[model samples]
Target: MASTLHDVARLAGVSIKTVSNVINDYPHVRPATRERVEQAIAELGYTPNLTARSLRSGRTGAIALAVPELGLSYFAELAASVIEAAEEAGVVVLVEQTGGDRDRELELLRSPRLKMTDGLIFSPLGMGQDDVDRLDVPYPLVVLGERIFDGPADHVTMRNIEAARAATEFLLRTGRRRIAIVGAHEGEVIGSAGLRLRGYREALDAAGVPFDESIIGYTTLWHRSNGARCMRELLDRGAEFDAVFGLNDTLALGAMRVLQEAGLRVPGDVAVVGFDDLDEARYSIPSLTTIDPGREWIAATAVRTLLERIEHPDAEQPARLLLADFRIAERESAGAALDSASAALESAGAILHQGAGADA
Candidate 1:
C-alpha cells in the first residue's frame, strides 16, 4: 500500500488542501507550513500520483528534448544540463536523437509522440534556414542550436560569431600570425562552421593579417577523425601555420594528436585552441583552451522559456532570440606559456630566419 496525500496532511497536522498547495508549488503557501508539509511527505515516503495531478492540472508534467547526436560531447553535456534543469523543476525529460538528419528532424516536428509532453526543446543540425517554416509548431517549443533563426518559436543559442572572434583574437595576441583553421565546411555560409569561420576572418581582418586559404582545412564533420585528417592534409600541403584553431574541442584534440605525431610541439611549434569548453577538454593532454559558451545557461533558459509558453499558451508573447554569452577558457593549450620571453624570442627568430632566406 502507498501513502496518500491524506497521510501527508495528517502527519503534518494540516488540511488536505494545504498539503496539495505545497505539492503543487502554489506561491502563496507560507514557508513554515510548506516546510512542515514537505517534511511530513518525506517522512511518510509519499509520492504524488502524477496521473491524478495531471487530471486536475491538465499537464503531463513532462517535456521533450531533441538533439542531433548525444555522442558529440557538446550535445551530450547540453542534454545533461537540460535534464538537470528539468529535474529541478519537478518535470521529466524525454530525450530524442535525430542523427542530424533533415528528414528525421522534420518528422520529429510533426510526430504524434510529442503529445505525451507539454512542450519540446529542439536542437537541429541538418535542418537549415530553408526549413525555418517547419518550426511553426502548435506547441510550446524552444529551439536551440545555430539553425533556422527568427522562426515562430523561441530560440536559445550561443553568440557563435562573437565567441569565435574572441578565440581567434586570443591566438593573435599570443604572437601567432599564421593561424590555421580546422573543421571548416566547404562553401558554407549559415551554419556553425560558416558563422564561426566568419568570426575568425573578422578577427584576422581587424589585426591586418591576410587570410590564407591554403591553411584552412575543410571537413564534412566536426569529429576527431576528421580533425586529424584535416591536419594531416594541411601538413602534406606544406601550409605554413604557427597556430591552429579547431572549431570544437574534439577536433582540436584530434588535430593536436596529429601535430604531436608529426614531432611538432604544441604552443612551441604550433599553438592550438578550440571552441566548446567540454568537461573532457579540461582533462585532455595539456588541456584545451576553448570557449565556455554558457551551455548550462542555454539549457536552463530553454526550459524556463518553454514552461512560460506552456503556462500561458494564449498570452500572445512574441517569439524571442536569446543568446548566451561566451568567454575563453584559458588553459595550457594556448595559455600564458606562449607569452614567455623565450617563446617570443623563438617566434621572432623563426620569422627573422624566414625573412633572411634561411631554413628554420
Candidate 2:
C-alpha cells in the first residue's frame, strides 16, 4: 500500500495537520517544523492524494494550455517549458491544439472542458484583437501571444516590435543596406507578423535607410516553406537586398537554405538573421543569429500568474500585459559578416523615420 499522511506525520513526530500545512505551503508554519515535515515526506515517499485534495479545495489541481499547432518549433518548445513549470508547481497540464483556426479558438474559450481544469493558459493564433470579449469566461485565464491584448485576463508576450527592430538592426549593422523581410502578413495590424514588421520599419527609419516595399516579403504562415518561397519570390522580383530577416527562426532557416541553393553565400553575398532563438538556430549551417525572447520566463510567469488567479478568484487585479525582454544572439550568420553591422543598423534607424514621415 502507498504511504499515508499518518505514516509521514508519525515519522516526523508531527500532527497530521502540520503535515497538511507543509504540503499546502501554508504560511505561519515554523521553518524547523516545515523542514521536518518535508524530510519525513521524502523518507516515506509520501505523495498527496491530489484528487481528494481537489475535492476539498473545490479545484481541479490541473490547468489547461491551448495553443496553435505544436509542430511549430516555437510552440512545441513553449509547451514543453510550460509543462515543466506546471510540474514544478505540483499541477498537471492538459494541452490542446486549435490549428490556428479562428472559430476553433473561440470555441475553446467557451467550451465546457475548461471547467475540468482550474485555469487556462491560452495562445491563440487565429483570434485577433476583436475576439477579446470571448476571454470573459468564468474560469481563470492567462493569455499568451501578440494576437490579442487588453483582454479580461493576464497577458504574457514577448516584445514583438522591439525584438523585430533589434533583429533588423542586427542585419543592417553588418553593412547590409538593402535588407529584405520574410514571413510578413500584409496589412496585419494586431498579429505577430504585423507588429514585427512595424518594428522592422521603425529600425530602418531610424537608420536612415529608405524602406522599399519591393524588399518586403509577405506570407500568411511563418513556416519554413513560407520563408523559402518568399525568398524565391524576392529573388525572382530582382529585389536588391543584401540581407534577410526572417520573423522567426524557422523562416530564417528556410530562407537561408533557399539563398544558399541560389548560389548566395550566407554572410558573404547575403547575411541572414532570424527571431526566436530556437535550438535549431545554433546548429544551422552558418549558425543563425536570432533573438532570445525570454521563453523560460514567459512559461514560468504564465503558470505562476494563472495559479494566483485560480487561488483568489475575487482578486480585483486588472488584466496585466507583461512583455518579455529580448536579446540578439550573435552567431556566425551575422557575426562573421562586416564588423560595421552595428554602425549600419544605427544609420538604418534614420531611414526608417524618413519612411514613416512619407507615410504620414
Per-model CA lDDT versus the true structure: 0.88, 0.87
By summed lDDT, the worst window of 10 consecutive residues in model 2 runs over 351-360
User: What are the per-residue Cα lDDT tens digits for candidate 2 across 149-226?
Assistant: 888889988888888887787677667899899998988978789889999999999999999999999998889999
TM-score of 1: 0.83
Query: Candidate 2, TM-score vs. the true structure?
Result: 0.83
Residue pairs in collision within model 1: none
lDDT string, candidate 1, 96-183, tens digits = 9999999999999999999889999999998999899989998999999887888999988888888888888888877899999999
In candidate 2, which residue ranges exceed 4 Å CA deviation? 1-49, 340-360
